[model samples]
Target: MSNTETSPQGSQPDTPGPHSPEPPDAAPKARGLLRSSALVGLMTMLSRVMGLIRDVVVANYFGAGSSADAFFVAFKIPNFLRRLFAEGAFSQAFVPVLSEYRSLKDLAAVKHLVDRVAGSLGLVLIVVTLLGVLGAPVLAAIFAPGFYMNDPLRYGLAVDMLRFTFPYLLLISLTALAGSILNSYERFAVPAFTPVLLNLSLIGAAIWMQPLFQQPVMALAIGVLIAGSAQLLFQLPFLWRIQLLPAPTLGFRDEGVRRILKLMIPALFGVSVSQINLLLDTLLASFLQTGSVSWLYYSDRLAELPLGVFGIAIATVILPSLSRRHAEKSTEHFSRTLDWAMRMVLLIGLPAAMALLVLAEPLIATLFHYGEMADRDVTMAAMSLRAYACGLLAFMLIKVLAPGYFSRQDTKTPVKIGIVAMVVNMVLNLILIWPLAHAGLALATTLSAFLNAGLLLRGLLKEGVFTWQSGWFKWLLQVGVANLAMIGFLLLLAGSAEQWLRFDMWQRVSHMAVLVGGGATVYLLVLLITGMRLRHLRH
Candidate 1:
């Protein structure tokens, strides 16, 4: 592995090769983290809005039915692997090393690492994609065993769709690799915006191509396949502009590639515990009822909106910054960066979670209760949505906290914590599933997330890697008061689920807009009144 300690101050000599237009600043400025995070957040918000629209369309067409269940499972298998390998482990592993290279080596050396990693990753993905295509039945059966045993038709649909969607793993993982590179250079917008293509492609497929398919859900599968390619292609130009576009070369024996692999292997388990737990929920939910998987999917999508937009946006910006700080041996800056991230997570995550919990039914009913999505589907999905919402803060915490370890290239501690959390989740699933059914699975995941977040925070504290910044008590109290105020406002404004159900789509949209906008306004006002200021969030 490249030595980061060589440059304790993180000063780089001017070396010839392509480099980012931005200057290399070892110490993070007050606006840098917040500005970059906002840019990424804005782009991610666009993608997530499109994703919600796509889900709304899918719900109108498929609803929480057997076909929807099949499609979700098929899509989820690759999506799970994408998060596990690409976004979760690969990003966690690659960014820190990339940061080291950029800080210590010339741009030429950085490009070489990118090329070798690309070639190696691409080769593995091709083999995996081919195997997944050929073994769709096996994958489907393993992921959704209930379908295999009880619903052969659904199982068959899932198997067929898996053949189409599984290749998405290969394409999207490459996209993620490109994204990680872009992120390392602080080019956050393109990668953050790339997901909009997926949502757009899926929306186009559902609207235009569904009629051509004998099984309409299969159109969605084709959409997934197309979106993966589109997303990968979309980032290439930006990569070229940055002059870090990879020219693939086999480099399994290369030192940097080997190091990334070593880190990524352990991180596969450590960084993706939440995804693994969700997949487990899917696995078990497959057996519960026809629509259990779909209910969970809908609810999870809504839960992911704030997470993707804010939690991930913040994490994405911080990893490269944190890694640079670590490379510079700037322990105080690293801890401060983390503290800033945690505060941001709490500032946004608290009210978001409360709003989701308070307005779960209304959100589900407004966005998804249309056409084929029945009232019962909305009710069931809302239940799981609320359950997932309860864990929103924990989920966001994990996003921010895990990066603290990953930026330092320490994956083992999170792996151990993740294992304990996963086991506890399984136990909770078994104990709760009998009584609460699908929502039980959601609840179990939520509870396990709290455990995961708590352990991660504890580890960081114990290591003295993340010291508590002063005024935390005041920060928490202010956030708590603001959140309580938001909750009360939302509960007062958000009518019953049945009222939302009876309203037409326009009414639902208007009412939801008011509740969301109002609740945010109230929360911000309360926080400001409690003496919080924008400057407090600066690192």
Candidate 2:
């Protein structure tokens, strides 16, 4: 996860070590990838549990009110910047450089590389943070325009909260750097699980902060600032264990650091386009009505559960392998490796995406439609959820495909593609917003995602980096068949779930269990009938 891995200074092709090649019967690279993915998935499951708890508390406390709306928009600003810079673009560039350093067995070189990048990044973050702090009101205005026009007090409060919490971008970005270094070393669980601390800190704050402040929203905002600090500190021990814990310095002369900056500039757009696109929707939604932000947030939270579990796990596991393979110039390995990962992504991502579309209402009702959230909010959120699900494959593909470009040290390509797709998204959003309202914005995001995925695939083909095989078509057919089976199973028998789907906590669990269990069985049964062997991706 360290910037050293992807830093421009170390952006060279991977060379084979003396022991690079193994026998053909040797362990398939996909197996190691899947194994690490499973470990990360397991840890992420725990983190998401805490996340759900945190969200439930949030919904209970705020209930899609104006206060909740303001808080989400405020929180999203720094969070988006954190992802845009640290975890998203900066790390993508940094990973390859750091990995190259490891491949070359250059420890001191890696340390110096780490110091330079970390120092330079820290300096950049401070300036960015200050600028953002000064401009929180304007930034909020841009991201959620309705806030300024409709509710002056909420907007002002959001600005003050942003000022308090904006430092989180610096801390979390640095934390992400630490996590990236650990991930490069195959220590996936610790880094993956660190998010749990965030949820816990927020939960603790929510419970205790209320007693301290008469205004619950202000308390929530202060809690957010505390939680951000907690998340940064939580990753410290993990960094120390890996011996890459960065010390404070101002040494920005290192060339490795320069390369990371080079890659990061492009990745800022390439990686953050989806969020940026979503932010655009939030800005538009601000004008629609109250609770628009909450509606989008709730819908996205449902989709994010599966995306985090499967899409993120698969992407995180395969990146190092992809980087290593590309560095080695093993074309066969690279092509086969990518194909295997795509299969894995589709394996989990498709079903997760589909389930949400079919079970949107039930899932939303079971999880949300309680407290002050209301039936109408649930309906609107469900509509948004289905729209979001429609593009899940595309969203997941971006995660998989962008890595192909990043690993090849070609961040510029995705940036170009992202720009085009973003333009389409903006146009579609404008066209659809009037007719479909908030749901249209979501649909626009989904459509633009598939467009981005298509472009990335085309680039991959043009460069001859990867290609489809005979099995690819067969797999697609099987996947379609499985999807049809899932649709009919749920569509025909959804009445059965009505009895099981109650807002009571245990009842909600039982509902998700029955639907997920029944739906999964049908998918597997169809796939088995169509000869979709596990051997394809599991190997």
Candidate 3:
């Protein structure tokens, strides 16, 4: 359970090395943290790229119609479950406890804890998956009731597809368990890379298996099940190498397992507020005009690229590190790590948000204006994409800040904040949905994210868990100037959404590439000119 890996700049106590021995005086090192985060970010970047391709394939085939709407809703159910249980509450609760066991106990104890958790989690997931499958029709009504009333065929199809997708919840949750253990060991790459398997499976299904299915979208559901299994299987060897492979045993009463379950109960709500908000968006979108679901799906995917790559990558790396800091009673280092993460979020998230906002229409036009995707669909999706873009920074901030509480085994505070955010989202949804339609749902979600992030930050400060570092004002000024410069550069080169729609596929792709590349170049150049350096990026 100990990390023996040496750091590039000599070994740190918390530096994770496969099959390495622990050093008693090991401290959390900046270089080590950065390395872990970069590795996860790069792998996530690849997965997001593949995910984009998968979306493109789906758009080309199904477009934003009833069929696409049905599949998106079907897929969203299992995926929402996966994120909520596997990556959201479960990971947050499990990792901190697991990290404590590893840091404070022996290898045997750690392995014992793993076995009990795996067994308990596995048993519950199996039961949930069965229920989800059996209740697919009921779920279809609950998630997309508009379909049952106005479009029975789509409703029926969603129910059928969900039966295939529901099993993914069980498989991916177990996969998440494996990934969480690896993260505790500081082996971040394998888990980060696991998502690429899903993207590839969906892409292959869309390209190859879709033609074989009587209803095309069923192929994607099957692909999801296959990907779930592959991702779970892929983590086994890594776990074995680390010698923490579980020998399953029912551990409902196991002390460590009980602790995790206790933590997870509130975390279920605390850690997944964003996902819950998004699910609400999907539910509301269902009652909107047809194609609303698909438009939101596409727009959300674009916003998620940066969120997944930088935001999630940072959150994933920090949780285990923060857990280790907490276990070691290293309050100062913990504060520093949290501060570093927040700074990184601002540095990367600000520019990413600006770029998404500036290039929303061009990006949608370039990516999805294809066979089944009409010009109108492109316009609708871009509208929501911009709406989602508005919350990109807030979304990223929540990813890091929530972990600040979760790593400390403090779940109740976040739950309170989450409830407030959820209420605000619902109210804003009703207020905004009437005027902006599908885009309004996206806007409500964005606004709620700000509320969530702000509350989390306040909680951390009130508890004295984090102290503001000096020079924040100057740092913000630097980021603000760089973003303004990038926005100006993009605006000068930008064309109207209609003009973007007029271009052919190759032309659209080429023009978008130039805009993206040029924007990134300008942002980086402005940062450098403002006296920000590579070293300043490190904590």
Candidate 4:
């Protein structure tokens, strides 16, 4: 047995530091996840803050009318492909392979693999962008057929805007490749901060270009191009620092390149399930009302704050590590590592979900109530945010668990589960759209996510993918208990805050302060009282 995987081929060992005390029971060390998640969170905060600035400009410049909605549709097309090819599908396949390469005894082959894959993916993304730019109208029709059917003006605008943003597919896809590279090296700060560059670029474009363009939508499209370019170019320095500055051989003969292609083919389909689910959600939302798409978009933006910052950071960091351990046949180490990652995600993700659901209104009201966003928009957005929160835990779990499959090169399993969830989401959308309106989209997404997470977990268990210490359930129960205690205080505090209605800005601020302060106090107290003590932080 290799030292890392003596327990089970897929198991992870507990990470222990020389100075750390032993846990009362065997535990997975999650310090790396914590450090990485927190760093990603801090950086994401900056990005989201900038993103909000960009949105504020958008909302003020183009409210939830046909125009804003049209522009968003154009924007999302390239974005959908970006997630599918670059960040979502490509990275899942790339990370593990790169990790395996890094772990290999042969360094020369590793360098060849990296250069060849970089050259190949770069070429592919460029070609995809060209095709998308050329076929923008056709692509727009697929996503928003209802619009093209109803209004030629809107349809034409969607095509124009799509042309401007199609390059985003190339930039962000390559950025994802760069990020996967940096993440594999454990030098995560650059990739974590890269999106902030995009957000900032948009914010600048929003401010400066508002007066430049004859139409605000044109300005927004230009901003998207600038932002996409910024995100891509920003990662180059870091790539050089890591000596991953590619010479671009584009060699098809490399065994590692061939292996990645073989794996990515299946994983790409798996990734399409998640992205297609969103596109499906958008299509169904379009049939409801003009504003429906934006509402879901805004809520999803909020939910992803936690998911992107923590869930993604951990998933990215651990996949490579897990891949290496499994390759070494370190069964115990693999299971232990998986246990630690799952536990940490559960412990942190559960609380964030609860807090979001509880504080949905205040958060929306605070962050988005300015500019052209009215109180009514806040209410609808908040409602959708709460609904999205219902599945925040599932989203994070999928982020963590999907990596487990990817690490072991089981891309087809996630693809299978993802397709099942997409089917569930599509069916629910068709059935519920008339009844619940946009809210149905949110609810359907949440339900489908749960279905996806459940399937992944079932697959893992059946395969004995990762064994946990016997007290896994007990740990979950403890987290649940602490969150329940936190919820009680939130209910009471929210009720009290509701009393201060007709108030000045300071009064509103004070009310928010009290609600935030009191709820946070209760949450921390409950955790401390229960001896949580960041128990999962060791790894």
Per-residue CA lDDT of candidate 3, range 75-99, in tens?
9998898898888989999999988
Q: In angstroms, how far off is 186's CA in candidate 2?
A: 1.0
lDDT of the structure predicted as candidate 3 = 0.88
Q: Per-residue alpha-carbon lDDT of model 1 for 175-203, expressed as tens digits?
A: 99999987776667888889999999999
* Deviation in Å, model 3, residue 468 alpha carbon: 0.5
Which TM-score value belongs to model 2? 0.92
Once fitted onto the true fold, the runs of candidate 2 whose alpha carbons sit more than 4 angstroms away are: 1-31, 496-506
How high is the CA lDDT of each candidate model?
A: 0.91, 0.80, 0.88, 0.74
lDDT for model 4 comes to 0.74
Considering TM-score, where higher is better, how would the candidates rank from best to worst? 3, 1, 2, 4
lDDT of 1 at 236: 85
In order of appearance, the predictions have TM-scores of 0.96, 0.92, 0.96, 0.90
User: How much is 240 displaced in model 1, in angstroms?
Assistant: 0.7
Q: What's the C-alpha lDDT at position 469 in model 4?
A: 68
Q: Show where candidate 3 strays beyond 4 Å.
A: 1-20, 24-31
- Evaluate model 4: give its TM-score: 0.90
Which candidate leads the pack in lDDT? 1
Residue range 1-539, candidate 4, lDDT tens digits: 01111222211223222322433123223335566666666766677767766676677667666777788899889888888778877888887887776655344555577789889988887888899999988998889887878768777888999999889888788788878887766556677778877777666776787678776677778888888778778877666655566667787777877878878888876655656777887876766666777877777777888787777767766787787677777878777777777887887788788888987767666555556666677678777888889998888888888878888888888888887898889998878777788887788888898898888888888899776666776677777888898788777676432333334456666777887677667777876776667644556
